[model samples]
Target: MRIVDTHLHLIYPDRFSYPWLATKPRLNWQPWTHEAYFAEAVPLGIETALHMEVDVAEADIMGETEFVLGLPRIAGAIAACRPEHMNFVDQIEQLSEHAHVKGVRRILHESPDDLSQSDLFIENIRHLPDYDLSFDLCLRDDQLYLGVALAQRAPDVTFILDHCGNPIPNGSGLDPWRASITEIAHNPNVVGKISGLVNHCDPGWTAETLRPYVEHMIEAFGWDRVLWGSDHPVATVTGGTLTDWVKATREIVSGASPDEQARLFHRNAERIYKI
Candidate 1:
């Protein structure tokens, strides 16, 4: 089956500075180009990809979108935004003009728990519907409730939950995180992305280790509401190559019918992001 990677990050050191990369020596050096990505992904059945923001310097956010849109096989982008900042509305208005700019992401997973809960953040998100933009919510497992609150506040805007809420597979099944995911999935405005779980699992984790978490997300969100992403270089940290991650995902979803797999891998994203 064909696939669309809804979350891929492209890093160009010369054009932009990624402040978050300063502390992580491993991710700081390389340029992940469209050529490099396709060389590996194309043979694996990935026909198109959406570039997720690398949290590049605040000034280069639009530049990142422009660079990716210029690439041949790239379908779209989920650019970065700082909704906490006062200029968020203006930024959204400007980005909405770009036809390939599909959505916006603020890496809440790295920020303090209360950062997304702020009134300013919630108010800024309320403006997304005007531009028909969706928000990619990146938060840790514990912060899923905050995701719930944000979804409640902006009923008109579509929200894509990244990384299955970042579940830690080493732990027992569905502690506080599972409850939060269940609650968040109850909201019709929210959708789930089944990516990034590899980062939270043991380095040698097998498909069985990943099954429960993936199955729970599918059960909660349903096949139509779930999408797939590579989470690329970050998945590298967990010792799984992008191909390995995709293969694992295929194993987990092998039981689903052909139509359901199509939605999870490609169609849902095309519809949600209008790709």
Candidate 2:
């Protein structure tokens, strides 16, 4: 099946400051340019990709989008933003001018839970629909309810829940994660990304090991609301290569009907990100 990687992070250390990479040596091995990603992704059936922000320093947010959008086959970008700030509207307006800026994402998983609870954050998020931009929700498993709450508040804004709410299939965490998934799926505005699981799962994780989580996500979100993401270099930490994860992901759903596979591989992403 053809693939549209809804979550692709391209890192350019020389042009942008990625302070988080200092502690992530595996992902810091080199900058993951669009050229590098396409070289690996093209042969594996990834026809297009939406460049997910790497959480670059605030000053470089627009610059990062500019750089990635210049590359070939990058369908669009999900940019980083500070919706908690009162000035988010200015940033949103500037991003709206760029056709490739498909959505906005704030790395809320690392922040305090109350960060998204702020009135300013909620207020700013409500304005996204005016610009027709979506939000990518990147939260740890425990923070999912907060994600659901945010989506509930801003019914106008489309919310893409990243990393399957980061389920840990190998541990006891599945029950709670599954519960959150059930709740999040109820929000018609929320879409689930069937990715980053490779990064969260055991290093030697297999397709069978990932079946329960993947199957449940497909069932909960329904085929049309689920999207696929490589999470790329981060995924490499657990699955060895983007190609390997694609293979494993394909195997995880190997038994599904062709239509189901098509939706996860690209159709859902096309509708959600409009890429």
Candidate 3:
């Protein structure tokens, strides 16, 4: 089956400034290029990919989008956005003009919980629908309620929840995270991504360890509203390569009908991102 990776990050150390790189010493080494990615992905049936934002220097965000838009197999890109900043409206306006700029993401999981709650931030996200742009909500398991609030506030805009809401399987399953995800999924405007689970598991986690969370997400949102993302490179931290993660995802969904798998792996993304 073919796949569309909705969450692949492309790094350009020379052209962009990744201030967060200094703290994340491991990711600072080299750029993850399109050629290198295709060399590994194409054979695995990944036909195309969307370039996710690398949290590059604020100045380089647009440049990063333009760079990815220039790549051959890059179907589109999710540009980095800072809703808290005063220039957010201008940034969104400029990003909307880029034909290949499909969506936008601001890494809320790393920031304070109250970040998205601010009136200014919510106001900026409210403007997304005006440009036909979707917001990729990246929040921790504990912060899901806030994510739900954001979704509720902008019911007209589309929201894609990244990484199965970043559930911590190692911490145990079906507790607060499950309830939160279920509530969030109830919002017709919100969708979930069945990606980044490998990083939430124990280092030696097998397919069984990751199954329940993925199953619950599919149950909550249904296959039609869910999408897949590699969350590559970061998956490496959990002792699973992108190929390994993708293989696990494929195995977990093996029992589903072809149409269900098609929605999870490719179709949902094509519709959501307007790719």
Candidate 1 per-residue lDDT, tens place, 1-275, comes to 89999999887888888888888666677877788888999999999999999999888988888888899989988999999999999999889989888899999988998899899999999998888899999998888888899999889989999999998877644687788889999999999999998888778888888888899999999988999999887788767788898888999999999999999999999999899
Give RMSD to native, each candidate. Answer: 1.3, 1.1, 1.3
Residue 241, candidate 2: how far off, in angstroms? 1.4
- Residue 98, model 2: Cα distance from true site in angstroms: 0.4
Model 1 per-residue lDDT at 209: 84
Please report the TM-score between candidate 1 and the true structure: 0.96
Write one digit per residue (lDDT tens) for candidate 3, span 1-275: 89999999877787888887788656677777888888899988899999889898888888889989999899999999999988898999999899889889999999989999999999988998888899999999989998889988878889999999998888856688999999999999999998889877878887788889899999999988999999876677777778888888888999999999999999999998999
Error of 3 at 255 (Å): 0.4
Candidate of highest TM-score = 2
Total clashing pairs in model 1: 0
Assess each prediction's global lDDT (C-alpha) against the native. Answer: 0.90, 0.90, 0.89
Question: What are the clashing pairs of model 3?
Answer: none
Better of 1 and 3 by lDDT: 1
